[model samples]
Structures are given as C-alpha cells and as structure tokens.
Target: MAKAFKVPHTLTLLFGMMIIAMLATWIVPQGFFQTFINDANREVVIPGTFSLVEERQYLTPWELLTAVPRAFAAAQDIIFFVFIVGGVLAIARRTGTVDALIGRLLKKHSDKPQKLIFMVIFFFSLASGAIGTAGEYIPFVLILVGLCKAMRLDAMTAVGMTVAGYGVGYGASAFNPFTVLIAQGIAEVPLYSGWWLRAVIILPFILIAFHHVWTYAKKVIADPNQSLVADLPCPLEGKEATVYPELNGRHRMILGTFLATIVIAIYGISQHGWYLYELGACFVGWGLVITVLGRLKFDEAAESFIEGVKDLTTTAVLIGVARGIALILEDGQILHSIVNGLSMPLSHVPAAISAVGMLVIQTILNLFVPSGSGQAFVTMPLMAPLSDLVGVPRQVAVLAYQFGDGFSNMIVPTNAVLMGIIGIAGVPYDRWFRFCMPLLGKLMLFATIVLVLAVVFGYGADLEVASVFINNAGVVS
Candidate 1:
C-alpha cells in the first residue's frame, strides 16, 4: 500500500498554507455577500446576495509579512488570554495542588484506569459541548499529560481525553454560540431550536471517542515503550510517573478554589455570555489567590510564571502565524470567492444530497477558515439559501456548518488551539493525526447520516420568510 500523506511541521505547513491563501486572491474573483443586522443584533449575511465587485484588496510580498503582525494585533485578546492561562497553570503547578490531586486519584484507581479515563473525557466533553470552551483547556493539557503518565498512558491518551474530547463536544455542540448559535441565527432558525436531536447525536460520538482513546491507553500501559511519543521530551519528562505526594488539607483548599472558579466560569458563560476576556480575568484572579495561598515568595512565583510563559512562547507564535492564514485570505478577498464556488454545486442536487454536500463543503472550507464564528459568518449566508432551493430546511444547513466547522479542527494544522496544545505536550502532528483520523472519520460518517435524516424528515423545517433578509434581486425567488 502507498504510504499515507503526512502533515509537515506545524509552522512550515501553516506558512505554506498562508502563501496559498494569498495566491488564491489573484486567481479567484473578488466578491462578497451583503449582510444585515438581525433582531438578535448579529451581523449575518443577507441570503442570496453575493456579487462580484471590483477587486481592490491585494497583498504584495511585504504586505504578506505585515499580515502576521496585523494578525497578532487583531488577535491580542486571544494572545493575552493564552499567556494568562499559561501563567495560571504555572502557579497551580507550583502549589503542587494539581499534582497532588492527580496522584491521589491515580493511587486510588491505579487498578481501574478505564474508569478514570471515561470520567475525565466525559467531563471535558460536557464542558466543551455545553459551553464552547475549546481554548480554555490549553493550560490543563500539561497537567493531564502528567496524570496520564502517572497512569502509564501515552501523550495521545492525554490529548484524546482532553483536546479530542473537547473536539467531539465542540463539533456536536447544540448551543455553542461561536458555531451552532451563529450558524443557526444566520439560517434564520431559532437559537438552539433542535437541541434534542443534537443532544442525542452527541452521545454516540462521545462514546466512540472514549472507546478509541481508552483502547490505545490500555495498550500503552501494557507496553510502555509502545507509546507513540515514548522518546519525545514530554512535559513530565524525568518525573516519576508511578508515585504522587499525598494530598494535604491546604492542597484540598487550593483545588476547591480552582474547581469553584471553573463552576463560576461555566455559570457566567451560560447565563451572562462571558467570553475569552472575562474568562482570562478569572484565571488571573485564580493565579493571584493561589500564589498567595501557596506562600511562594514573590521572586519564586515570578520565576515559575516566566518559565511557563517561556515554554508556551513557541505555542503562542504558532497561534499568531496561524491567524495570518485567515488574514491573508480576508485581505486577498478570496474567502467569499471560495464560498461562492463551493455553493454552486448544491443548486442542482437533491435535498438529501445537498444537505450532505453542504457538510462536505463546510468541512473543506474549515481548512481555510478555521474559526467557527468566522466560518459561520462566511458560509451560512450562502448555504441557507442553497438549502431552500434544494428543499432542505435551513436548520439542516446550519447543522452542516456546525459539524463541518468543528471536527476538522481536530486534525487541521491551521487550528492554532489544537496545534498549540499538542506542541506544548510534545506530541508531533503526525502522531496526533494517526490517532484522530479513524475516529474523526467515524464521527463524520455519523454526522452525514444525521444530516440526511434531517433533510428527509424536515427537521426544524419551518420557514419564517419575513424574518430572513432575502435578496429579491439575487438568487432567492
């Protein structure tokens, strides 16, 4: 059999992709879909209103270099959030609270690692599926790695329980504002309108993910050297994996503080619509309190915090450069062109086929536009109308968009969050993909079947024509 294609170093591959996005601007006609502000106050694209405009925005070589810096500027909120998360993790680690807890748990369940695996994966899945908390898990990636080692598991298992678990939740989310909510709003469906079906679909996918990760983890435990990154310098390299300090009362208090903050964060997200900036502040306050509680002298705390930042410096740069890929596409004004090209084929397909086709297009588009909200804003406008022509419900199109925007992030090099977290844990892209591809393939298959059923059954098919901004002069009748 021919060898499968391997993704390159994350940076090298992303920079190359950035150049491809730039070149696409020259080849694809510059165009955009007109947008309108909805009652919910979101700037969603006006359906069926795409037009060819004079192409004014183009990137020169120097302009391309400038895009990286501009991306950093535009993404400062996320950039700082990443730094703050790193510092918080460093403080927590210094307190030994995280390690102590992991140690105790391992000691208690050392003979029943499968129970521990399922619980951790499920916790992450619920957090991500319910709240769209993808990036917030980065700081915990290293901590999970430590725990996995203590249980005789590999880096893949650690990520599978955390990052991939989040991916399943995120991909199958019924109410994630960044993906599901925005796409539904654009499709003119009630926010979280068909959550019952989505909730049902999410369970099977999570179970599939858990089984795959658990099986691999058990194998690694049996033969420790069988681990994919057995030779890599992991975050817990040189530490004894089998032994952990007994948890003291102070440690319990610190952990209680951390857990309470997580609950508060979730509450804020669910009720108050808090996002990255506010969540970053939560971590900031957590770090301050933990540092004082742990009684680390100022100099010692500062050193650990800086050391954490230094470790994540590469991860941070990878994220900023990944942002450049999207920026170049936006600057080149080819993102809409690509969307237009992808939408053209669906016009003639059967409703069921068109629904699945939307999934395929959105999945491919995710490689170029990795941001969930960004992809929703770009694709949902066109997809919703295409669904109307083919007799599929607009909500089904939103389903396609949400599923497409999500699962691909698990393996896409352009996904800065996944790549950054993997890099921090010393797992190569190739190794991670090897573990994720088969599982992701199964999830994609499941998603396609669900989408086809939605189309056939008219799931959430009600149309509120007056609420939708139909382009009378454009494609809509």
Candidate 2:
C-alpha cells in the first residue's frame, strides 16, 4: 500500500494569509483606517478626539520571531494537558477499563439508541463547557469515532455527529465559561442570566444534530460505494486507540475514578464559578486521580501524558499562526475598516434584517478572528451600540455575535482543532464542508429565528434578572 500522505494546504494557506495580513498591518496607516470607522457610525458622536493616529510600535522582525516561541509555549500548555489525559487514557485502554464500561453502558442502553446518543452529547457538551476549550473534546471525539466504527457505522458518521452535537451544545452553552460567559462578559450581561433560555434550545438542537448524523450514517451504510463514503485513512494506532478497551476490574476502577472526577469537577464549577484557575485545578485533580487509581508506574503515566501533548503540537502551532493573523489585522485597523464597510449596507434594512446583517458581519469577522471573546471585545462595543441604533436590542446583538461566532466553526480554516480533527479523520476540508454546510445552515437559521423571536417578545438581556423577581417578588410590591 502507498504510504499514507499528509497534505498541508490548509496550514500553508493560513500561514500565507497571516504573513500578508501582518505585512499590511505595518504598511497601512492606522490613522487613515480609524477616520473611516469614526465617520461610519451615524448614531454616535464622531468624536474629533478619536482620530486614527497609528501607534508606530509595529512588532519588529525580532518581535515576529519572538511570537513563534510564545505561540509554542501556549501550544505546549495545551499539549501537556492533553498528553496527561491521553496517557492515562492509554493506560486505561491497555488495562481494559474503558472498553468494559462502554460495553456495560451500551448493554444498559441497547433499547434506546437515541437515548445513548443524547447522553453522549450531553456528557461531552457539559465537559466542553466546563473545560472552556474544545481541545479537551478531542479525546471524546476519538472515542466516539472508534465506538461507531466498531458498531459497523462509518467513522465520518461519528465525526458528523460529534462535531454537530458539540457545535449545538457549544452554541447554546449553559455552562461554557469561555464562549458564553466570556462573550457575555464582553457584552456586559450578568453571568447565568441566559441559562434557562439557552437550556430550552439545547434539546431541540441536539435532536437536530442527532437526526442529521443518523440520516447521514444510514445513507452511507446503504450505499457504501458513495464518494463521500469512500475509505478514509485507517485510524491512528498506538496511544490514540487507548480511549476504548475491553472491560475489566482495573478498567472499572479507572472508569469509576474518571466519572467521580467529572462529577466533582462539575460541583466545583458550580460552587466556585467557571474560571481558568478553577478549570486548571479540576484538570490537576483529575490527572492525579487517574494516575493513582490506574496503578500504572509513574514513568509510564508520564510518557503517556507526553505522547498526548505531542499529538496536539501541530494544532498548537497552527493556533499561534492563526492568532498572528488577528494581531496583524488589529495593528492595521483594517478590521474596523471591514466592519465599517459592512454596517451601512446592513443598517439600511429593517430591524430583523439588520439583526441578520449583524450575524453575517460577525461571521465574516470570525474567519479572520476566531476567538469568541476577542471578536466580541473588538466588535461588540461597536455592535451593541449599532444594534440599538438599528432598532435591535443589545441582547439580540449579543445573540447575533454568538451565532456568527459559533456556526462558522464548521468551515473556518483558522480553527486549529477543527482542522486537526478533520486531519485525524482523514477527511479533506472541502469534503467536510460539503457534508456540514447544510447542518450549519440549519443551526444558523434556527438560532437566528430564536433571537428574532426573543427580540419580538421583548426578551432582552434582563430575562434572568426578571426570573429572580418572578421567584421572589410579591404582588403587593
């Protein structure tokens, strides 16, 4: 057989774009760009004081070189964490802990495929929300794919299901500290205010995802020769295979410990609130538990951890390179220019149209700037006020940002994890998009409709605060 091939077009294109964007950042006069944006916002005062004066402290060539190391360091932190989990998972697999538990769970849920799917989605979604980074979900994705394959379902079916479920869960996240709370924080909404409303949407979205994947899987199974169902690269061997295993006593102990750690972590987040510090503590505590309960020698566990981290090195580097693109756009002030360019045309439409316009704008911006919080930081201040001027509520504007940011993960090249997962699955970017775009459309449309309805019903940012009154207020008052 021909040696498995690795193509780097996505990575290459990302780097090339970053270089071009960064160079333009240095060459474009910052003053010229700011003047353009200031002139664009009609409702707000175009403060003469707010001039586009370019700060001349462009990153030196040396500084650009320095970003490489800094990027690597960030990547290292992510890789180290993954390595620890992966190593323990590998040990668990070798010991047959994971396999046994999965078998038991499957048997218990055999009569309810839909229930099993929902449980998996819910469990992983909760984990992603608590962890705050989708990187943590990679392991679960691997496990899902393997289980699906073992059950005679196509692997990509698992891919579609996992990614779509995650996107929906992440989109309507209740406990996501990173995307939800962070975006809310930037938009100045109180924490947990939107939880009940968000909760209402979760089940529907998860069902949509489940149906989407089930349909796709049935088609592939029925027509094995379909182009989309063509053979993918064989699954990664060695440590990657550790997430699933045959059931045994050691496996039961490790699985129990893992489940307990998850329960405790959720409790910790509820008590302490979700923050990186709390998250880090949870990871550390879980790692220690897995290390001790699995009974692996310390050296063996450490090696597994290192291997897991190594798996993500490429992704980390891609993330850093991707971040540089945003930094460059920030320096050039071109990001503002792009927003200004979009706002006027969008503002002319009716309020609902304008709301949709904001989502489209945010979607465009997301390709260039993938960070949910960072995008909100740069765009929301302007978006919030612009939304009000265009007769959209501030909260609705936030929802627009959320949909725009969340839905495009299915397509964005700059999302390293998306790319990394696709690479692991051996699906081309174009192929994945072809499969996912329809589902993305459904999600985006559903989310848009929800936001529009919320706006129509006067469901503003204060819904949660209102809930408190309903719970606590007296008729006399």
Candidate 3:
C-alpha cells in the first residue's frame, strides 16, 4: 500500500498566524484604532490612531521585572500542589486500591445508563470542585477516560461528558477560591453573594451537557460503524495490566492511612469551608500518608514526588509563558485599550446581543490566557465599570466572564488540561473539536438566553437594588 503524503503546512500556518496576531495585539497602543465613535453621541467617524504610550499609566519597568519571578513562583507553587496530588493518587493506583474501587462502582452503575451518566457527571463535577484548578484536573480527566473504556463506552463520548460536566460545574462554581472568590473580589462584590443565582443559571447547561453526552454515547453504541466512529482515533496503546508484588503489612498500613486522610480531608472541607490553609494542610497530610503507606524510604518518596513534579514542568512553563503575554499587554496598557474600544459598540447592541458579545470576547481572551484568576485580574476591572455604563449590573458582567471562560475551555487550543486529555485519549485535537463544538454551541446559547432573561426580569441586584435618592421638600428655592 502506498502511504499518503502529509504536509506540515497547516501547523506552520497556525503558529505563524498566532504569532502575528499576538504581535499585532502587543504593539498596537491601547485604543489606538478605536477613535471612530464620538464619546457624547456614540456616532461613527473615520477611525484614527490614539497612542497611550505618553498618557497611559502601566506597570513600571521595575514592576515588570519583579513580576516575572513572582509569576514564576506562583506557577511553581500551583504545579507543586498538583504534582503532590498526582503522586499520591499514583501511589494509590499502584496498590490496586483505586482499581478495586473503580471496578465496584462501575459494576454497580452499569445496569442503569441514566444512573451511570449522572454518576459520571457527579464525580467529574466533584473532582473539578475538589481540585479547584483547571490545570490540576488533567489527571482526573485521564482517569475518567480510562474508566469509561473499562465500562465499554466510547472514548470520545466519555471525553465529551467529562469535559462538559466539569466545565459547567467549574463555570458555576460556588466556592472556588481561584475563580469565584477572586473574580468577585476583583468586581468588589461580596464573595458568594450571587452564588446561588449563578448556580441557578448554570444548572440548565449542566443538564444539557448530560443529555448531550448520553445521546452521543447511545448513537455510537447503536451504530458502531458510523462515520463519526471511524473519525475518532484508535484506543490508546500500551494499556496492558501489570502485576505487582503483594503488599506487605507496612504497605497495607500506609494504604489505610492514605485512604483515611482523604476521607478526613473531604469531611473537613464539607464541614468547614475550604480556605488556602485547609488546602495546604490537606496536601501535607496526603504526602505524608502516601510516604508512610507506600513503605518507601524518605529518599524514595522524595524521588517519586520529584518525578511527579517533573511531569508537570512543561505545563508550568507553558503557564509562565502565557502569563508573560498578559504581562506584556498590561505593560503596554493595551488591555484597557482593547476593553474600552469594544465596550461602546457592544453597548449599542440590544441587551441580549451585548450579553452574548461579552461572552464571545471573554472566550477569545481565554484562548491567550486560560487562568481564571489571571483573566479576572486583567478583565474585571474594565468590565465592571463598563457594565455600569451600559446598564448591566456587576453580577451580569461577572457571569459573562464565567460563561466565556468556562465554555471556551472545551475548544481553546491554549488550555493545557484539554491538550493533556487529548494526548492521553490518543484523540486528535481537530476530532475532539468537531465532536464537541456543537454541544458547546448549544450550551453557550442556553446560557446566553438565561442571562438575557435574568437581565430582562431584573433578577439579582438588577431587581431590588436601586440607586439612592435624597430629596428635600419640593422647593422652587
């Protein structure tokens, strides 16, 4: 058989286009090309350049230099925490504990498809909540994919469900320190004030995602010879089982300690809200439990931990580089420029269109910067003020951020977790996108309509909250 020839042109073109677009965004002064509208009447005119280099305030040179190390440190800290979790889980898997647990759970649910789908969504949602960081969710995603295969489900279907469930949950997060608290803090709203409302809005999307996945899986099962099935990549190779030496008493004790630690951690979080301190304590406890349970020497455990951290080094580096792009945009004061330029045109649109527009913008921004915390830092300051000017409440603006950030994760090329998942599943990015884009579109539309209705009905602060008025006697004096 003659092999088909392939060209690398597409990859090269994509990289070239990305670089050019980034450079264009970087060099253009904030608002440089946004002079078409008069501020008073919002009338259009010929667009002209407006440089902020002289008038704009931004991070000082010293600040920029200082931020690099600070950003790297923060990235490293996140990577370290994720690695510890991964290492502990890896050790647990090696002990056959996780395998036994997964087997039992799968068997219990396999008889009921609806129950199985709900269970999958529930666990993925729980993992998203537990991990609290998109980057940290990679291992969980891979685990879910493997579990799906074990249940004889289609891999892509599993990926779609896991991504949809997790993304929606994370989008409507109630207590995520990174996304919810940080975004609310930046918007100057009381933390978790609109949380219940946010959850309400996102619930429909979550249900839609469940339906989407279940239907897709059934379609594949019913027609195994479908073209869609042919398009998906083969199951990942080299998945043969391996035997390990029977655990000694020390290993058993260690395994028991590790399981107990996890239970305690979950219970504590449920009883008392999870804060940074709690998270730190959990990490330390888990690491110790794994070290003791694995019956490994200090050096051996350290090596395992280090190896886990090393696995995350590439992701950490990517994060830093991505952060650098934000730094440069901030340094150039272009982020503000970009926001200001878009706000007026968006405001002129109908409320529904404007709301959807905000979602779209946030999604594009997410492609370059996937960290929710980092994005909030860059966008909320601008978005909040703009929302007030455009007759949208601060809560709506926050929701827009959440919608854009969360939904786009399923499609964005820059999300490391998505890439990691694709790599693990042996599915190509294009194939995953083709399968997921329609579902994402439907959910995005559903969310947009919900937001539009909320605004129309004056839900949240838009309803009861009003500007204060002080009046003396109606005097002509």
Candidate 4:
C-alpha cells in the first residue's frame, strides 16, 4: 500500500519560510534605494538612486530564533485586534445571538444556498472595497462555517465565500484607502481620481468570484467526498456547534449594538482617522456593553472571553511568524535589491505591455511584501516614475499596484489576514492554496486585460490637469 504525502502544519510551513529568508540574507546582495519625504509627507524612494552597500547585512541563525518575539511585538496591534474581535464575538456567541442568527439564516436560505453565497460575497466585497475592511471580518469566519454546515456545505465553501469577496474587492477596489489611496498619493495622482473604472470593473470581478465559489459549493453539497477539507477536523469542534435560542429582546439589543459599533467604526475611520487601536477599542467596548446586556456574572463572561481567544492562538502565532519573515528580509537589506532588479526591465517595454508588466511585478513583489500599505510605500515610488519611462499612466500604475496586492493576498503565505481566516476556519494552508490558486489565475487574467485597455485609453489624463492647476496656483502666489 502507498501512503499519501501530507502537508506540514501551518507553524512548520511558516518557520520553513523564515529559514529560507534567513539563508537568502547570506547570498543575495545587500543594497538600498535613497528615499525622501514628498510633499504629501510620505517617505518615497528617489528614482535611479539604488546602490549596493559596501558592507553586506546578513541575519544570523540566532536572529532567526529571536525574530519571532520581535515580529509579535511589531504586529501586536493586529494581534491584539484579532484577540479583541475574537473575545467579543465569543461573548456574543454565548448570548445566543450568533446561534439564533444562524438558525434563522438556515431556515430562510437553505432551500437556495446560492442566495446565501452571493449575499455573503457581495457584503464582504462591498465592505473591503469601500472602507478597507479585512481583519474586522474575522468574527464572521466561524459564524459562516456553522451556517454552511447547516446548509450542507463544507468549511472550504465558507472560507471561499468570505475570502473571495475580500480578495476580489481589493483587486478591483474603487477606493480602498489602505492600498489605492496610499498608492495614488505616493504616485502623485490626484486623490481618488480615475476611480470610475475601478468602480465599474469591480462588479465583473465580484461576479466571477461568486461563480467560482458557488460552483465549488454546489459540488460539495452534491457529494460530501467532493469537499476539500472532508478529512480535516472540524473548526467548530470543542466549541458550541449551534444553538436555536428563541429570539429575545436581549439578543436584538446585542445585534443592534454590534451593528451600531460597525457604523461608528466606519465613521471614525473615514472622518477622524482611526486604525487598529481605535477599532479594537470599539470592539472591546462592544464586549463590555454586551456583557452588561447579556447579564453574565463577571467570571462567566471572562471565561467565555478567554475561551474565544484560546481558539485563535494558531492564528496569532502564524501572523507573528509571517511578519518575522518580512523582518528577516529587511534586516538582510536585500529588499531593495530585489525591487531594483525586477523593475528595470519594464522600462524597456511598450506602453500597453509595460502596463501588464507592472501587474506581474506587483504580483511577485506581493509575496515578499504582503502588507497592502507597506507594499505601496516600498513599490509605488518606483512604479510611479517607471510609468513615465514606459509610457504607462501613473494612475494605471496605481491600479496595477491595487490589482496585484489585492488578488495575491489570497495565496501569499505572508498575508497575515489570510492565515488568520483559514486558520480560524480550520482549513490547512495546502488546502487553501489548492482552492485559491485557480481563482487567482482568473482574476489576474482579467486585471491584466483591464490594465492594457487603460493604457490604450490614457487613464490618467486628469493628473496633467491637476498638476497644471497646482503649478498655476504656485505662480499666482
């Protein structure tokens, strides 16, 4: 008998990547790009300023061992944010709100599961595209998993719905501040300029994503053997599987309080400039309010909160290790060398082809640099100027940045948000990789086509107008 080869555990996979990154420090040339703060108050790379350092910077094996804690410290904001959301949602689940809602959804949508799938993908996509929501959706992962099980689908289907919306929204983001806004501002294009195309294009991407997920879901429902994670343990095991509490005033209050918190959080983000800390505080506040409303003894609520966080331990560790991988590259000083080498050839290509080339470069770079805004900071300055040399519009470059960063997040091991989602869902990285790679191919193909069309049509004409207006205003002064 032949035994099947197995995928390593998530921790093993992440640590393996960290080791590889450490070894690369010894071999890859250490280099850097000179940077300056632009008018927008961003530190941006000065074009053509790349230089190899006289002394090489390489990380030691000892440093690789210690990078874990340092990465946790660096990513503490996101880690704590995940904890807060998990703890708060656990308390809500104890209130029977989650179970009640699941029961209601199953009754209403079970007959036509496609409706549930579409709505889930659409709502998630809308949130990510409009307001840059990703980590906030962590609370929904288990909730959707339970609902899908009730609807006779598998865990992979649940994950596919949540992440597909998230990934595609980002890929075709009309105005995501984390990726698009930062990329645009760094590229020196007008803020939110040339957004109509993204807004229009997002629908098709969403539809394609919906079709892919629904198709898989249909198969899983038709035959249990068709499920990707059938052999894997249940994510909902050891946790409350489901509850059908009768609707009560307290449950409504909790649901309202949760929805109100999201609205307030969104408002704070768009207006007062909130980040993870503020958002975490908001979720914590929701936890406190629900605690009082659910009438839990202090000890009971506290235990539930701790239990909720306990389940997410793997997710947090994976996130920290993922950050550590990026840290190693930074310490090695090979980050800029990779960026400099990959971008040079694009300068020699035709405009339309160069536009597509930017997409490819951004996709490859995303594997090394997974943070959306972080990638913008590292890549945009070069991509913005390179657009001029190759006859691609700066706005199109920003679009390339958006498309590349958004879709690749689904498959990139360094994407902490992704690791968190699938970990919480109990889907192994190998299984997730198997499911997501094909979808990424389709979305990437669509994005490449759009970038070429944008180049053909001159997408950034308004950048010239905006620049002229700024220059004329300076002349008057």
How far is 46's C-alpha from truth in model 2 (Å)? 12
lDDT scores in order: 0.80, 0.63, 0.60, 0.88
Candidate 4 lDDT over 1-28, as tens digits, reads 8989878998899999999999998998
Give the clashing residue pairs of candidate 1, or none: none
Ranking by lDDT: 4, 1, 2, 3
Best by lDDT: 4
Query: Who is ahead in lDDT, 2 or 3?
Result: 2
Distance from true position, residue 371, model 2, in Å? 2.6
**Prediction 4 global C-alpha lDDT:** 0.88
Off by over 4 Å in 2: 1-8, 23-50, 54-68, 74-76, 105-115, 122-133, 174-197, 224-230, 238-246, 267-292, 306-312, 416-430, 455-457, 461-477
- Per-candidate count of clashing residue pairs (backbone under 3 Å): 0, 7, 1, 0
Q: Model 2: number of clashes?
A: 7
User: How do the predictions measure up, each by TM-score?
Assistant: 0.91, 0.76, 0.71, 0.95
The global Cα lDDT (0 to 1) of model 3 is: 0.60
Report the C-alpha lDDT of model 3 over 1-477, residue by residue, as the tens digit: 998964333233234434444465545665433323333233221223334555544345555556556545645544455555656555555445555545655667655656677766666665554345444344455456556665656668666766776787676666666667766766656677776776565556667878888887777666766425455554432431333234456555655775576566556655665543465467667667666665667777666657545554544544443344455554455655675565557767776667777877888788766777667766676676666666676777778888888878777755655655554455556667778888888878887886797677655463225322112332312
The candidate with the higher TM-score, 1 or 4, is 4
Ranking by TM-score: 4, 1, 2, 3
Indicate the TM-score of model 4.
0.95
State the lDDT at 465 in candidate 1. Answer: 49
Q: Which structure is stronger by TM-score: 2 or 3?
A: 2
For 1-477, candidate 2 gives per-residue lDDT tens digits of 998875455567666777777676677555422222322232222212234563654656665556556555644544444444454455555455556665665557545545556666666555554445455455565566556554545557666766665566566777676567655655555666656777787777777777776677666556765536475553544433334445667666666777776666567655665533454455666656666777767787677666655655555556556556666566556665565666668557778878888888888888877766666666776776576567776667777787787778767866655765665555566677778888888888888788778767756646445644766876323
